[model samples]
Target: MRAIRSLSQGARTSLRQVLWGLVLVLALPTILVAAAGLYSGYRAEQQATDLRMQETARALSLLLDREIEKSVLALQVLAHSSSLARGDFEEFYDRAKTSGLEEPSWIALFEPSGRVIFNTRVPYGVKLPNSNRMDALQRVQETRKPYVSDLYVGSLTGQRLITIDAPVIIDERVAYILSLAITPDVFQGIIRDQRIADGWNAAVLDRSRRLVARSRSPERFVGQLASPNVQEALASAQEGLLQSVTLDGIPVRTYFSQSPTYGWSFVISIPETELAKSAQRSLFWLTVLGAVILGGILLAVLLSRAISKPVDQLVAAAQTLGRGGEVSDRASTRVLEFDTIKRALVEAAAGIRHHEREREEVLAHMAESEARLRLALNAGHLGSWEYTPATGALTTTPTCRAHFGRGADEPVTYADLIAQIHPDDRALQKESVALALAGRTDLQAEYRVIWPDGSEHWIRVSGRMRSGPDGHPSMVGVSQDITERRLAEDRQALLLHELNHRVKNTLATVQSIASLTRRSGDNTDPAAWNAFMDRLHGMAKTHDLLTATQWQGALLEDVLKNELEPYQDGIRQRIRLRGPRINLQPGAVLALGLAVHELATNAVKYGSLSAAEGKVHVMWAVTSGSGQPALLVEWVESGGPPVNKPERQGFGSKLIQRGLAQQLGGEIKLDFAPAGVRCVITFPISTMASDQSGAAETQQRYAS
Candidate 1:
């Protein structure tokens, strides 16, 4: 032992160095591990950033596509103007002005030669420069379809604008080109409204790679070509992510999508630093770990222990943040790096809270919008539904459920929905759904549905098929109850048919009246013709009364008042007309009208109405005769020249006797009383009473 102790201290120092070397070798992997961790973290951040950018780009692309589609739809509507088709330029300009007044962009109509015929922004006589490249217009004219043009400077306003052109085809020839000019301000607003991340920029490019709109510094970059790298990337793919430098020499990670409607590209470029921030933090921590490794072994152990506790605390805080929990200030570990991580966790928590609040607000707005939609549907008697063909699942709004006579909470399958349809309409509904799902055509059908209560309702359904997230077929549609409208149309058709029939019957009656008058030699003299005309006037007054009653029936009092109106004008007090408010059937009204006409004519000529001192009393009563109800009408005249029986029955008298007896199924007696003339007419009331009751029932049923 003494001899070993005699060895140099250098040997002991060398053994210690070897042990330290082994420890250094083992610690070298820690640096490598930290580097690998930093790289992995950077890759993850890049992936996340890419996903966000792609989503933003897609959303912007969809919004721009919708705007273009709206412009096209508006142009198509304007193309159908009747004035444009009729070659009325002045009228067409007026209509276009009215239509464009509320639009965000201006509208113009151009001749086939690219000459402005009408412009909403300028007067009719104002001349404007023609486009050097009229590819959009020419394409629309050739294809007879809508076309969206590349960005250009407006000739009138000198502002950057894009045009959507639709051809107005008449008689299989292009007649006019309707164009709508939209400014970049519209797309600028859309980009701003999207709430993109700070330090992130978005831009829109036309098919030619020219900048149509830029979310940042629009005035400087708009109308300029995009960066060469961006153009090359977009040219190769419809949508993708890539790293490119902006025109201002700022490197960015970009996501771009090409629009299907306009061939435009939407780009969302996030600054590279945003993605590098996480990697920088990781590298900084790795450097700190390497520095700790360079310290003495005991110091390294102490430093690791010190760093480990704070790191554990930071990890717990991060986990809490990931779970959407609030981070407390007590999470601070008093270590600079760890404290920074804690602060970042707290900020992340705050960001999550903010995002949650926004989500809640969005949900509330969606609820309000849904409520408004329901109210509108109820007001219009409309219902909406969605059906998934794969699952046979049907989702219906409350209004739609009610239309099918289903409870609010009832689960409805596609088959259940089909079952509610009327048997005659079920096949049609099935065929329409099949066609829609097959992408053959849109679904549109007017059909009847039978409710559980045994009542049928006519409903019009219109919808289109769409692909779900998984590419499965689904249908979204609206239904409207058109029962009342259908019934009204039916009533109108019946009225028209009745009008035609009544006109034919009236014409035949007029011929009969003329023939009867001529056979009686009434046309041989002027006085006779005048008397015949007066008789015809009486018939005309009765016809007016019947028409006013919708040909359903006329009141007995109304018939008498019409026939006696002329005679009673001068002798109001002398004429006494009284009767109960009895409704007569149309047939009864016509027969009674003729009989009253004859009676009035005779009275005006030779009876009480013919003299100043003459008086007439007309009355009717409902009385029981032979156990059946009967209407008894008596027309008596007094205070006139003494009445005498005619030698031969004239047409007037014969009409009252024969027509009243045959047409009214009644009895009539005319007595030549010395006091005056008295006529008694008796008819059974069964027909009129039954007819009145039936009409009342029909009206009540319809009302119910």
Candidate 2:
């Protein structure tokens, strides 16, 4: 204690020393607070960057998994094709070629012995290269499930690619392995299309820790092993953030996400420099504040006695500002120097508040603009893009990323964007882009993009080119999904073709009915002519009913009602009809209509309808027979006269028993009851009963 006191006394308490002491006291806390604020802000920014990286990696992982699943699904669908099942290798090869032409994927069928049976890239019977990998095929055969292979050099194309294989099961055994081979170029395109900020990087690693693709410097690093630090970080967790160095030896803040489906990982790495920017800015401001405070303290020391009150007030105000608190307006001191200083403090506070409010307003406007952009993109199914030809940079909206089957935050290049387009459409798209860039024409193209999952979409793109201030060409455009419109067009064509087929069938039927009617009797016979006309009218009624139902089928009750319409009278209940409603195909409708007409004619001439007191009771029902649903119809007559069997089978009887049976794919039985005539028809309900339920259930349900 004596030594420290003696040293302090030797230093001497000069006026400048005292002022320096005061400045130290005032500046220490402010400096400490500023350092703390800087650190806190740095931490917040670092955390935000990590979170964003994690989210991007996770999203990219999910997209890759979905793409793998889609490829497997496509292979499965191809495996089940009838052509493949029939062992028509030539036909199947043609179909596979056409299907994969857009994707530029090679579709192949391989035997269990690892021999290629068919490949879309080569002629039939050509053998695949010996080095072609068959592990995925073997796995599919063993598991009888789809399997996606790891990245490898495809022996046929001598390119880095992956294969997705599905087993074709036949007679409870694996008959063949269907495979779809895709190149890494597609996945590279996916990585390149991510919308990452500048200086950030992303990569996709296969199960082997080999880089399958990278968003930056892909051509340089793809197929190489990932950095040891990244591999170590991933080994510990399926998803996490870490501080690491990239393959290029640059330090970065990295995040990784592993895919459960494909055993692959997506990684996002942001340069550490980006996180340091905010901290550096904070330090700059702190240094400037310290300098200003030191200058003020020196001035205060010189005029220490005269400016004591003002300096104290100024210090308080500075502390308030440093703490980000509002300053209240004060009355003028009336002295010029004091008032000037006070006014400056107030104006500084006002300026800070004004800037803060402006910053908030700007942030709000940016958020609103983003929201509106999202709404427009979603509502219109639109993907917007901006392309700079010189830089080859293709910036896209979130919807555009989705359209290209990329993660929302992925960056894209012009080459990567064009590569995602279907091979068949790439030439045209390239030409259109060239024309636009050359200022020869506005760009417009309708093309297809084959996604990594093997799903294809039609896209219509429209854009205009503009010259930048530096005279470089750029394009602004929107792409819309037009798959639905294309499908509707296809459906319309199919419907038109079906309409033509039905019209020809109808004409043939009319011609046959006319010939049959003419041959049954002489054309001169008026009764025969009348019978033909009546039959024609009955056929027309059936057709009308069928037309009303769009030719899907006609209700049995509707057909019966039309045939019995001529016999109905206001006062007489001569015909009684009872049945559960049944739907019949067009063929059943025609045969049944003629049979009912014949029966009615017979009843009018010789059965119950022959006398006023006579009555006809017609009933139909669905019943189970031979373990299949069957339709049963009964015709009974009463109160006319004693019924007798026909001497010889008439045309009506043969038509009802034979023609009706053949047309309906069912059976018929004619019964001659003692008191009246009865006919019972039984037919399989396969075609006639649209609903397979028993007639009793149907009737009960209808009643309810």
Candidate 3:
């Protein structure tokens, strides 16, 4: 309102004067255009309605022809009856009667001249009526095919019927004519089933334009001729629509289709009342156009009043919103454009209010998230950056600039970031970024970055493509100095490879020793040599268990089970093992594995394991002895032959007694008492830290 009031009028004429003249000039063409629009719409609706009607007629025609074809097919099948050729009238009569012919229908045979041979409706050898359907038989004889007759009164039945005739050719000549006569009532259901709307009528008509079936008053119109308009249409075209009157005297627009097969027609008639709807719609448009032309006279006056109301409402709504208030009142307008503007203003104001609330909430969340992000980036030494392609601007934090070998005060560019990359990785980095852009995937590159001091460091740059505020492509990402982590990873890989080589060599030596022991053919005691081989296998199994943990440590129960599981064959409760979960350094895993193997071998040879019911219980747990934590594993045997202490300690006994206590700084007690052989191994529990390979080295060294 303020701006409009401030406008300077350079001329005397107001906009009303100019528009009043313009409306006078354009009113003639405007009327023409509106009339044309009305005509076009009515014509389009009529064309669509005509197409639908024509299709319905065509479909119904085909349906009626198909029904007649069914009768023709039945006649053809019955014509091949052997009874007809042999002149067995009684058998042929019975055959035709029981040939599944429809009720109120009959099959008959006639000579080519239409003399009746037999009729199924009468008894055998009875004098039957002469066949009066010679025209259909002549058609069959001439065409050498089946023929369908138009609606007619049958000479025998004395009722309106249609005939289907097939030629029973004998010796390449028309021998007999087989006929099936069905009443026109068979087609009444088909016409009625169309379910056309009220005031619309559908029908099936024979070739002579006589009604075979009618949807409206079938009893009155059936067998009667249609109006002349339909007859004239059939003469000119196979399918068409005509303005005519139905046989019942209803004025209608009729659509008709003639069947190519039976020369019959299907006609659908719509009352003129139904077709008047399109005309009514056209009249409605004409009235609206007339009102518009008259309304134009007041348009300039109304627009002048209408424009100011909406404009003033818009100003009022803006002021209310500017003052943090809501505008919800609405008023009617005479101009359509003003009404549209009012609706738009209402919806836009509501949206702006909703957006303002959402914007406040989002800004709060963003501030909190940004604080957490700053802490994480500083703690992890990550360098953040954002690039906008629209403005071609690269903005980075101080850390990102430092990552690219630039001072905090220096400006950075994409080219500078690329130039600082090591030459070997520069091309690869570019290729990765190109792929990221093309595939819409994240950009991740690990390459060497050369600092300004000429010292090389590995830097990993990661980013994701996003859309900027201007809807152009942009990137937001972080970079980090991963030089220390990369060095550690390299060192770890080397150490693992070396450890694997050493473990394989050690296991190979143990296998060689076991093989040599197996081949000790001259040994006096076979059990002794086999026992040594079994111990070697136990060590190899323990080695495998330790390797699964990267040679760091293993479970104590796992070590004992590996050595004893093989001896638990005969299932008379031969062995039982119980232990709490406890981890042992690799040295303890190896040493305890050997001690358990010797005890199990002895049990099988002469201890509890020798008896079918003999069993060994192996249990271990952590206990405090002498103010230090120690792992105590007890191996007890029962239900075996009596045992006694050996006067001279054998190799197994000496190794268990000496090697475990000396190398692992643990105590071992082997008691060869009378009841069973019992051994207890106690070792102080060691730390389960990652850097415990030295312990495994000692065990492998001792075995070698």
Candidate 4:
């Protein structure tokens, strides 16, 4: 076997070979058919040759009959002349010879008695023996009709001829018979004088089945039958006829026609083989063409197959490699670069399988690790948080359940966490988060959380943001319960405040005692001494209560009612306290306590609290300030004797102004009205705790 090249060539080669063999098989019949056709033509030509001769002979006979008609006319002209009465017959004879007639070999005139009266070449009054023997004349006289005779030898002229005759009447009765004869030589001139095609002949014949003219060989046989093959054709006088004939044993095809005037036939004939010769030549050329085409197809097939086989093999080998199936090692071929690519792909496919297996194992391990991490976070009550700064996904951990008061299985989100923040603290948390995201502040917020049960707790959440590789900050932080610790610290501070209050109160009591003792040694300044005791006594009363409350704080109304009770007829009924409940800080309690005591002391000496109708209506309460919950306390005294503004700022003024203003972060105002004295002190509510334990006791003692 030869080496194959490509698949396309192989297909083409195989197809061409098959096609070539088919062409040869098909051409075999065509060649045989052409040979048969040539042999059949030879036989047909032989038959045609005979038919042509018969047709030619019939055509000549028809021309001869027409000639006989013309002769009879010429003979009638001479025989009807009555020149034998007037003169000798030589005049008629001379006239007949000079008439310039063609084709007729003899002319004669017969008398009424059936004797030859005039002949073109006879002496006058010749008793022509053949005149009564002329079949043409005898027939015309007997029947009184012109007649055309068949080919016969004339008795007088002794020539083979066709005759024509007519009667010449002398006195309305049978008179004479005039006749002319046509020789075979006249028909020969007619046949030779006409033209015919190559391999064809022309002829004329009479109704007696004799050839009167022939253009070709056998001209000597005029007045004879055409041939044994076509004799029947002329005997029937059929015109427009074509038939095959044999002339001298040679076949021919003939065409014949009849002349109506004289009952003759004209014909033309040709050999059949000559007419069909081109068809045989064409068939031969077609056979040779079929052979050449078959050879070309065979050569094309072998060349095409050489190319197709290798291409088909290469395609199969490449497909095997692509599927990672086994193929020959030599499949790594030198055919083309693409074959090398197929081999490389096979190697890559194997490596890919190994990598794929390893990847699956790694993925499974990662999944396991994730599950464990999720379990630990849920168990530890730790909320896991991951902040992706890029996407802004802040995922909270499982521990955030406590913050949101949600079950572990319950779905929780950042919005739920934010909703749990106390409304008052919500803005601060929002601001902090916003600042952190904006890079202006760290993530730190202390805000109150409203638990699911409606109890509030303060949480301190602090985180340092971690920067990602892209330099954006992300927050991570923790929060825990700090509410109890904050409450404990508040309680401890309140106790310390009480201790400080008691110490300050003890010092004031000692100062008041010394002032009283010094005032007792001065009688020369009674007004001055009275004023001195009044101020000193106010200090002493304030300290006495401070020591009793352990200085947690005191109410303003309690401190006033207690010091003025000794001067009231109906203690509870005489004094009135009006204001919302207010708790004072330890320092405000001390200063306000001293200021009220001084005013009551002074009243017994010089103010309205000194008289019998000295009923003190004291009212203290909180009022609105610029900030919504700011505290204002008003001290109004009424139903007392007339009052005057003090002439000087004394120690009483100093205590209210200096001590309360400096320590309590508030202001004190003293007004001396005509009917009573009005004093007001206002401060912040934030300075006092919600539970006024110490202040409540002072109010109870004063109210009782």
Candidate 5:
């Protein structure tokens, strides 16, 4: 202990000063050699710093991708749960609760429009509003692919988070979306695990160049945009190194790698001070060269020349490593220290290259994982069941019990399930199950179940038998609620019949128009033929709009917009249309489409649209303060040529007056004012859906 104290109290001495007193004349050559060595070492150290930074960037990038993959994998697993397809939210909620996921992570179910059905972040049955991730959900639905959303704020947690969404498709349509809300700490954990050194920086940025996780000042900078240098480096290359300043304005050399799977960039920055660390060995050799130079100038020159080549090689090797290129296995140098460094550099280059190869392989696998997530399988999720024939015991998922017409909490047994099946289909189901168990073939059966409420539903079951250790074959199978598909087939047949009846009615309407036009104008007139074709085209547009929605219905604004689209002026708003996107049923849509078509054509031919200064405003509103709300649409024209009432009503006038009443059970009023023509139509929403007018009324309305 006394010796250590005496050593600590000893004064420091300068080697150069002590040596200079003995060899003052040798100082010039020594300074020149030391300076040369110093410059070379500086360059080599800078290159090494860059290579290490680049390697750090790649390693962090791989880790970050793996972290994101975990969230996505969990989301996909939940998305495939059969309870979602069977409309069993309770089972889904329970499964999500026990998902075994870490904190700051939660699951959610969303409709295609972004309405949250349920969220595991909060208790079940909580009133969940629409999610703030509509754009991400919409993209997934459109592309039918898994997506990583940009940084967003969580609804329940109100913290900055990112979402990974996977679509649950049924009947080839995106029925629902499953998502995982991941806090930035999940990514920050990755950085924390790296244990990055002080004076160095690391960060993760989404595709928008916004910071997702930061190694420092995360609370203040987590969601902020990255520094300009980092952004440019990310944009410039898939992996690269560049000289820049940190977000804290510290000069640094930044290394970054862009993830091919998610398009995010991972960055690591090393300070400039680290690069300027002088090499101790090089300085020691320089002092030796100075002390020995006085013995022979030629020998000193020879030693200096000998060291220069290896220094260049080391620097060259580092540059090659930084560029991700192959390094040469050069022979050993004459200098022992240089030889050791050369070998080390060679090994490091190999190790880094090998790591890069592994990273590429991992990236490829992650891409495949993402691709598998997007495969659109046709089977709808419902429930799975396992049965032990020895004990006649049945274990079913919540969805499976629900398919048998039981509640989620209802206890079910094999006998109870068999009793629920229809009498006729029961035998067929038993035969299929028996055949599968005895012959070891796949079990396939379609049977009907009589619910306690007396509603009949179709269930499709498919499964296989597995041999147990006890020499008994256990039965496992999945069942689906195919009631919607079967009903769809029935609806298809009914629609075909309705289509035929509508075709005949459409012909009658066409005949009425031809007859009215023949009496009003000469049949051979080009104007009459043009008017007829135009009306046919208008009808075609309405059919196109309805077909796009599978004939379910369309918005009132869409029907009007389709009819008046030609007169729409983007800058002037000449044909002003103002209304909410009221969802009108098929009957209301068809009636409103034809009514608007007549009004628009008449105005373009003889009313306000005929004058240059003319304008038309078509507005609609749902009547309030009433028992059953009604729809009121008013078509008014102004700044027209004149207000001259037609002596005889043309087809346009009659169809608007009669078709609205026949097809929609509505009333229409057409009036001619000094400015132009005006028309008002009114109907009850309930009556519009019912279509009270029959085929006889339809033929009577067109009868002249």
Candidate 6:
């Protein structure tokens, strides 16, 4: 410690000695003034460089966003093209090749079952892999909607691409899937116009972290996971991020922006040295300025010392007088210039103190302003962030932390924010932010965030990117809780879906009832009419079962057993009934149950179940069909008075043949053999779905 103190003091003493010796000579003043001027000029130039760099980053982000949006638009156009939907492979292929569109681009169609109908990029007879459509086909077929898939390598073309799938619905059912593959070259072209400094690069990445295209290392880097910065940018998808990394052994600063249309991340990398080069120049000038200033002070001190030697002698005599040792009367007769020199020193000390006080006041005011600014930002729920396109350091505001469900005191950055966004939404959010940063659009999005607490919340964020003096973007935005709003909207959508379902069931019920009334015979035979009325009552009973359930659905077993209860007393011992545990749609349930009633009534009066020796058997089972499942049912009878085929079809025949067949999408077969009668019915599983309860009631009303 003593050595360090001694060295500092010694250095100070040496500096003073040197200054006292050099007077303000021509050489000292000239060098000092020139150095000071050079330093100021360097600072001005550095500021200009910063401004240019910031602009470049903003421009790059903008160009990337435009390219992505263009891709999305292209996909949409291709999806709606009638030729693409109609499987016009030859026309599509020819159009793609000759329409000035980029080559290797293709349009393809897939069936809801994942069968590829046609692909322009593939040979006319060649089959494309079914796996590519697996996920998309299921979602589109099941939900009947359009969806976008993440980037994948084309099994046919061997090129990395993203597929956009939209369902082709005909008669309210998905008929086919329209798909288009966007190649990486399209992304490459997007960044081609981006102006990157020498030794820098840019690229785009899909959600899987795969580099779809690159402006620099194009062919080599394709299919590789992007650098962490790119990953971060894709993850946030809403904000532009900057980071630094070593690429090909060269240290580079990278900026990442997102593409909303294509669900891609755009990354731009430049060398740190390029951005800091101006600062370095300024530093050099500052050094020179310091030297010159010191030199000027030294020169002035030396010149002053020479001129003040007489004043110093007079001060020495005054010190002697104060000590009671003064003798020379001439000491009081000091030169006028010497007296002026002493007065000037005293006034300069006072001025320096005054200046220090003023400087303190200015600093205090600045601190107060900063505090107020922070408070205002907090109140406004604004999150402020800064990214050095050259270094990748991202600093965010407290409000941003809260909005993202991070602790207010936790240190989070752009990369950290990106990591928190849901992967499905990250790419889109990043793209929007990039566009906003590029000044293409204002950044806005609703995204999901998984907080550290493991709870998820929806946030609606809106922000804008402003180009810094260095041309890089600084982002500022607000985030608010939209979780409740989104959930409510979802609930309303669900209720509407349920309502639509109920209305359809009701309509089917009305149709069945109308058909039954139309098929019933006119009131000419009193006995026949009386029997018809009894059948109608049975159908009415089924409708009651359905209406009680509000059309949600009903159990097939419950409806069937209820309709056959009256016949159980006399024929319970003579009957055997078997069927799967299943639910039924209202239309099918009512139709099937009432049709059963008609056959039972006919049997009790004239068929096998009519005699003491008669026996009746009923059975049902589920089986697979071309699409979902098929249900097969049989009713058999034996030991009746006599078995005979009906010469003419009656209401019973029509109900069993037409109503059951049409309503259940099933076949009804009746056989009159020497031993007894047998009836078989086969139908699709949809008929047995829980919503067909009203069908039974429809059939019952036919007797009325």
Query: What TM-score do all the candidates reach, one by one?
Result: 0.43, 0.44, 0.40, 0.33, 0.39, 0.38
lDDT of 4 by residue, 6-48 (tens): 5435665454456556666766775677567665765576457
**lDDT of candidate model 6 versus the reference:** 0.67
Model 6: per-residue Cα lDDT over 247-271, one tens digit each: 4555765656555544555566667
* Residue-level lDDT tens digits of model 5 in 1-704: 45645764694743333344435556675679677977687678767767877877887787777777877787777878888878899899999889987577888888998788888878888988787767888899999878988897766677898888898887579999988878888888888888988878888999899999988888988888988877876777899988898777789877899877788888887787765445655667677766666655555455555655676576567567667777777722334566688999999999999999999999999999866633422235658888889889799877889888798888899999999999999999999998988898899999999998799999999998987678777888888989999999999999999899668867876776677666656633457767777777887888899889877777787898899888877775688877554677776787788889888888888888888788998877656443655667888899888888878666677766677777777888888888788888888766554332221122221100
- Evaluate model 2: give its lDDT: 0.78
Pairwise TM-score winner, candidates 2 and 4: 2
Poorest stretch of ten by lDDT in candidate 6: 695-704
- lDDT for 288 (candidate 6): 69
Q: Which stretches of candidate 5 lie over 4 Å from their true place?
A: 1-445, 448-505, 518-527, 625-627, 687-704
Off by over 4 Å in 3: 1-34, 81-104, 111-127, 285-704
TM-score of candidate 3 relative to the true fold: 0.40
Q: What is the lDDT of candidate 5?
A: 0.78
Instruction: Quantify all predictions' global Cα lDDT against the true fold.
Output: 0.78, 0.78, 0.78, 0.64, 0.78, 0.67
Residue 242, candidate 5: alpha-carbon lDDT: 82
Identify the candidate with maximal TM-score.
2
Residue 271 of model 4: what lDDT?
Answer: 63
lDDT of model 3 at residue 137? 77
- Runs off by more than 4 Å, candidate 2: 1-26, 69-95, 98-104, 111-114, 123-135, 141-144, 154-159, 167-176, 195-201, 214-235, 243-253, 270-289, 296-665, 668-704
Please report how far candidate 3 places residue 152 from its true position, in Å.
1.0
Model 3 over residues 1-704: C-alpha lDDT tens digits? 45544453335765566667777778878888888988888898889999999998999899887888877877877777787777677787888889886567887788898788777777767877676656677888999998777898866556899877889986578998888888877788777677877778988888899998887788888888888878899989999999998887889999999998889999999999888888898988898888888797787668866666666677667667667787655522334466688999999999999999999999999999999999999999999998775686899999989887788889878777778889999899989888887787898989998887799999998999998878889889999989999999998999999789767756654564465455553454567566666667677788888888887777766777787787776562567776556767666666677777777777887899888767787876566545665566788888788898888666566666654765467888888877787788777665322232333322221100
The alpha-carbon lDDT assigned to residue 115 of candidate 3 equals: 83
Candidate 2 local lDDT, 1-704, one digit each (tens): 45645765797665556666877787888788877887788788777867877888898999999878877777787788899888898998888877743264788888887887877777877766542556666777889988777788865566888777889998589999888888777787777677667788888898888988888888899889998888887888899988899989889888899998888999888788877787888889878877887788777677665555565566566556657776545412324566788999999999999999999999999999999978887899899988888887788887887887777887766777678899999999989888887774678999998876788988899998877687887888898888889989998998899789777766765565566567667534446677767767777877887788887777777887878877876764888888886878777777788788888888888887788788888888776644776777888888887888877666567666665656677767777776788878777777666654435456331110
